[model samples]
Every structure is written in structure tokens, then in C-alpha cells.
Target: MAAKDDLGRVGEQRAAAYLSDRGYDVLDRNWRCPAGEVDIVASRAGLLCVVEVKTRTSLRFGHPFEALDDRKVRRLWHLAHAWIDAHPGRAVHSRVRLEAIGIIGPDPRSGMLEHLVDLR
Candidate 1:
């Protein structure tokens, strides 16, 4: 995989671990539809969470969370609905939310991860 792809995968993994440690039941990762992709699907406090993870090597360009623009947020909203439709058995009946997890730096152990919940 490309270096960027590796960074994203590791970042997502870290995000999942972080969420799991916080009592979030992670249901999926890289869930995709024609609309777009959701990096993590989790449930916590009776809410279905659609997570978008942004990973970066540094702030040279910008903070990773800064990448989530309005357009991407809209797409993620659609993708969250699509995920619910596709996984009827999972029964995600509670409220749905858009969340963002930003991972900065290369090392998963040392990187900064910021979880911004309820983006929408």
C-alpha cells in the first residue's frame, strides 16, 4: 500500500482501539456505498455513530480534522443512512450522529488523536 494508505489504516485502527477502550461497540470499519465511505461505525449511549477518520504525518498542510469540509460531511451523512439500510440485522434504530477522529503524526503510540463527536 501507499504510505498515505498505511497511515490511514493505522490511524483507523488506533481510532477503533480508542473507541473500544471508551466502551463504544465498533460495528464496522471502511463501510462504503456509492455515496461515500465511513471510517468507523460504532454504537454508544444508544446512538449510532458514523465516524470519519483523518490521518496526517504533520501539520505542514493542515490539521487532519481540517480536511472534513461541508461537502464531505454531507456525503458522510448519506453514507451513514446507506449503512443503516444495508445492515438491517444490526438494527441501528437509535439516533445517528456524525463524528470525526483526527490522528496526527506517524507513530500510532505517540500520535495525537482527537475525537470530535456529533459533528452533525
Candidate 2:
């Protein structure tokens, strides 16, 4: 696998741990469907959250979340809907939240993770 892929995986694991520590119940990691891929799917305070994780060695270019442009947001929305459909029991009256997580450091395992929840 490419180094970026490893960073992404590690970033995701960090995101899960971060969320878990914050009282969110994680339902899925790397959730994918025809629409797109959701890095993390979790529930908190009766709301469903779709997280997009971005990991980089540094912010020299820009913040990791900056990569998730409008197109990505739309795709994430579709992916969230697909996830909802897959789990009927968890969809009713639930709200969709778009979150962005950024990890930056020399290595994925030791990177600093920053989570920005409810982007949309």
C-alpha cells in the first residue's frame, strides 16, 4: 500500500479513538457504497455522523480538511444516505452530520488528529 493509504488508515483509527473518548458510538469505519466512501460513521446524542478523515505529513499545502471540496461533500452526502438505508433501524428520525478529521505528523501513528464535526 502507498504511504498515504497508511496515513489515512492510521488517521481513521485515531478518529475512532477520539470519538469513542467523546462518548460517540462508532458504527462503522471505512464505510463504502456505490455513492462513495465514508471514513467514519458514528452516532452521538441521537444523531448520525459521517466523518471524512484527511491525513498528511504536514500542513505545508493546507489543512487536510481543505481537500474535501464541494464535490467531495456531495459524495459524502450520498454515501451517508446509502449508509442510512443499509441500517434501517438506525435511520429513523436521525440527522446527518458531515465531519472532517485532520491528522498531521511525521508518521500516521504519532500524528496529531484534529476533528471538525458537523461540517454540513
Candidate No. with top TM-score: 1
TM-score of each: 0.95, 0.91
Q: Candidate 2 on 1-120: residue-level lDDT in tens?
A: 998787778778888898999998889888777766788888888788888888899989988988988988888888988998898986664477888888898786788778887785
Cα RMSD of predicted structure 1: 1.1
Name the weakest run of 10 consecutive residues (lDDT summed) in model 1. Answer: 101-110
**In terms of TM-score, how similar is model 1 to the real structure?**
0.95
lDDT of 1 by residue, 1-120 (tens): 898888889989999999999999999999878777789999999899999999888899998878888988888888988999999989455799999998888685569899998795
**Winning model by lDDT:** 1
Clashing pairs in 2: none
Residue 6 in model 1: lDDT: 84
